[model samples]
Target: MLEGVFMSFGAIAASYFTLAGGGGSSQYANAVLADNPLAFYQFDETSGTTMADSSGNGNDGIYSAGVTVGSYAITTGPGRSAGFSNDIGGTTDYRATVPYGSWMNTNELTVAFTCFLEPMGYFRLLASRYGEPGTDWSWFVYGASGTLRFHWRSSGGTNTNIDTGFTPVRGTKYYVAAYVNASESGIRVYDATGLVGQATGAGGTVNSSSRPLTLMNAATGNYTANGHLDDVVVLGSALSTARLDTLAGIALTPQPKWINRTAGVSARNGTTSHAVSFIPTSAGSLLVAVISTPAASSAVTAGWTKRVAAHGTYTECAVYTRSASAGDATIQLSVSISNVPLHYTVYEFPVGSSWHSSVSVMDDNVYPVLTGLPGSSPVTVFACVSDRRLLADTAGESVAWRYFWRTELSQETLYGGGTDGIFTGIGVIDEVYDTAVDVDAMDSHVETNGSGSPNRVVFAINVA
Candidate 1:
């Protein structure tokens, strides 16, 4: 029995089982209980709040309407979910007390949930004990996986995995159960099938007698899980194999696929080479296009592929471009169905190189203008000029003479060069405006116009 003395007799007040019609506060009446059982109140991005009564009076306090005999206290935060609660000192602002004072080394605790494969990333389902402000103890950290892996750790911060065993297949449901006990702490993953695999053999803090733990979807500024979570449950005591099976049988709450892709990406192209990259806003196969204004040298299509790698949470990709010459290029990334290889094209110049003078309407439209060079093969450097002009620095007075090619040309090429005082390329009288001139193609080449190398090269690419 709970610890509380009775004062008045039993009286049934108008219980608010159903949420008031029209509208109320953010709190909602999930169930109607004759006596208000102690509940953990949280209001953040993961778990939002709901109103109880229709007057919007249900702010963030412990209120007892049905039973007027004994009273319970609560800890309330102004805006978001505050720390834990002990109910001591009348719910002013105290941390939550750990159950049984502390954890028993022999005892155990486990949490289980269902997730999807939409937002491939990390999540945190913690067994935390709240105390003073900023003083919180977390037991486990786990979530969805793809190109990367997302798992949790104990007090020692050991990596404990929490995957569905089977690969994360979108539109499909999978269950992940993280177990923390005295014998050992491990994870058992399951897809639509029964049991996939068990990754036991990890050490963690044993919060046997911990406070009410919460399911936290935490992201460390990386890929986020885009999946649904349902049927969240906590075993009152250490769960056994039989108990785990029973709990898994129960229905769970459902969450939507998390879209964790960032806003955009930045990349560049190189002389006689093209660069590539893409930003995903959701979980789906995309088609990437690689195009050059005059077409690439080898007419080779770059192959691109993405998969769950790091931490098994986010998607990582790899693309390859064939040997090509100087040209204006762009890569367009698009999505298609699963199992189908990611579509991408390589746009290279047909005969000569092209240089972009100023920021044009196609500035952002061009994909591989400033892309990094590949490490495998050396790219022949070329620059297109309106009048076959020599590259010059911004000052124009500092005439560059010697050229230094890209040194950090591991993944991409970085070239610079030109002559300063006696320049004849820019004023070449009969030269065509769009003439492709092959410069020095080496590991690292510098463009010089004066005593030093050319300042910078201006280039343009077409998306169409």
Candidate 2:
């Protein structure tokens, strides 16, 4: 016979018990899918049964929240024990009290929990804030301390008690639930095995006087008791035993969705400087840009710009690899967005000279309003290298209109004969002469000894 006030599952495997006054291991007493998240705790004092005494270290005690934390403590008589046992042939005394707060209404109520003791002893769960002391509006106590029987007292001098020989377990999870439903008679008791006691009809009467429920330490007096408890659930609804067990069995993981998507991918390919665009193409979301140079004289500088298009020809977005050192440099590709979720796929052949910047656009976010050419949106990417110059496209037709692109590079008059203009030659082409290199972002200040040197960067736009 477990001889404690409550039984606690000590392992950290998601499920727990609240011996004395705690909400098991999850720290949440309630669990509701919609707006209800469990919130309850168990606490105990060094020696007393009051809330203040049991409030452990940190002043918040075992059952404390940011603002609304309560104190709880466990107490026992000389012959009491708070551990597991195979049989409950001995008598065990236990008590718990909420020093503060009022259980004024049915919206928030407190349920009772107890196990068997050779099928004898009184088990009372009451709420008392005012009026006639223990006989106030809060008169819900199950008197099952001696025989397998249950009794209830309500306001307006109403009372009812029933007898059911409940075969309680010696060491197990048991519950005595009370709530304000169409019939407040759902009061039930259970052992580790199954339901040991239940009322035949609605057994609880409602009182019009609104007073929070508070437990008296002893039914004979207005004080509280110090008892051990475990596995307490303060939920919005009374979950069935099967559902509760299922929840206790399942494990939960806590990570958002987006973090799983952008975890692994090279930053040095797909035309952007170390930044790959998840571009939706006729084929799929593929890496479609290269952002490095392959010759000493010709360096591939990559940059990207976004603009909200009230009216435009086609959807456009781009990513670039940070600039690389001159000669035999190209950002390589490793994976393609195939068999994955994408917004839309459109057809656009790669165009423009490898030296001249051009944008091969694709649809992202697939908004219905973006079906025409007028719907454009913008997003920002970082600069791989500052001081690298950019030149406007020589293709002056409306098809060559470059959108307003911004770079993080500081705007200073070029010194050291460094003019801010395009240095072309490392033009992208379908032919051979292959050499691709992935240059990681080289912090300009770090590589240049605090001397800001020009680094290769890419800035491109779609020219339809």
Candidate 3:
């Protein structure tokens, strides 16, 4: 048994435990979650007419016009999402209205959210403050081409519009943020990879209005959104591009005493390679964990190997690597096995941090366990790759996996599925990443088929 206070995973189905110490908080929680915004709606309630404000502000929202709580993609984590499907000519519409507050009466402001657009034939409003053309502000999709559009009226009765120029595809989730200041305004659109489209303009000052904030539709119930939305945030001041990118789940800026995780998966056959890059703001050691499916017919003799030339001085485990590099590091895995799947994760740790890793072969119940290092704040990341032989026998296998990552100040649990033996399922199945606050120990259980066939499991514990 590990010594220290144990934190529960809570609502996360994954079985994992952490030992607490030093009481250091997370950098991300401090930067993003603790920024003291005017209002923030996680949209995670199971059943409620009122959407609670997570920013500790008293600006609660009321559901209206048939807005329903629904499930979103795993990318938004385990939570309920707001669902909206507007009828072009019919009265069927939905929205959430938050009463007017001081935060809504600022010239310098920012609005951001994660939205899944279905793209109907007519114009659809994703969010707005009022319906008046020359006096209101709104973010919407162009009916003709589905381009993301932002419109805000200035104090002088002049209306400014910004376009992303890139049309949103139906049934895809996008992270969008729009801001307006006295001199300039802009809109940024991001997908899983990174920034996709952006537009900026100068000479526009936002005007204050008496209208309440409306989400997923116009205040007049016109042009309603036809999809899902979550993680709505409203700030009184404009945020930097780096901070916005971090909130959009792209990348986090590395700082002293900070931890960040980056992960991805590939199933290309015949001696292929997959790589991800990260630049540390300061010099430090990094903990890297990788899991790959074994050879199709036999156990993996020589598994994935990290390129020392590309990464740096590294210590390799069965499927994990610990690298000590300065400046920039590129985590590359060269796979020689044919027709197999590969998954890799690279975790960047700031100075004064250390990490340890462990690996296990899968059984009916697989637990990738790592003993905690003294004086290290521990956060655990686990990745499990299903055996290729088990997939060859089953035509359409749906594998369910759950994993959790927590920093001292916050924790996030995500669940996903994949087909066959390929860990290409939703969310973080093939690639797992997470960071935790002052933790002393780490362990987790991953349940798979009872068939004696073995899968590859990798675990890493980072102390800062």
Of the candidates shown, which would achieve the greatest lDDT relative to the real structure? Answer: 3
Q: Model 2: runs farther than 4 Å from truth?
A: 1-39, 44-95, 99-103, 107-119, 122-135, 145-157, 167-173, 203-205, 208-228, 231-464
User: What is the TM-score (0 to 1) of candidate 3?
Assistant: 0.50
Ranking by TM-score: 3, 2, 1
lDDT of 1 by residue, 298-400 (tens): 1223443221111101111222222232232334333211211121222232222222221111111111122333212122222211111123323232111
Question: At residue 174, what lDDT does model 2 achieve?
Answer: 47
lDDT of candidate 2 over 136-227, digit per residue (tens): 44434434543333344454456545555554433233454443323453455653344556653343444434443333223233322122
Give the better candidate number (2 or 3) by TM-score.
3
lDDT of 3 by residue, 1-464 (tens): 11111212112111111101011123322344566788876654434677777677778987663443422112312111221111122233446778777678776778877665555455666666867555555333232256887777777777777778878765345678888777788888876556788888664556777778877566676665555455677887888767787776621111222356555555554454555465555655655444443332212223223322111011111344455456555655554444345544445555655445444444323333334422222233444434343333533333333212211111111111222233311112111222321111222223333334434444444434
Residue 249 error for model 3, in Å?
A: 4.4
Sequence-dependent TM-score of model 2: 0.32
Least accurate 10 contiguous residues by lDDT in model 3: 13-22
Reference-based TM-score of each model: 0.29, 0.32, 0.50
RMSD of 2: 25.4
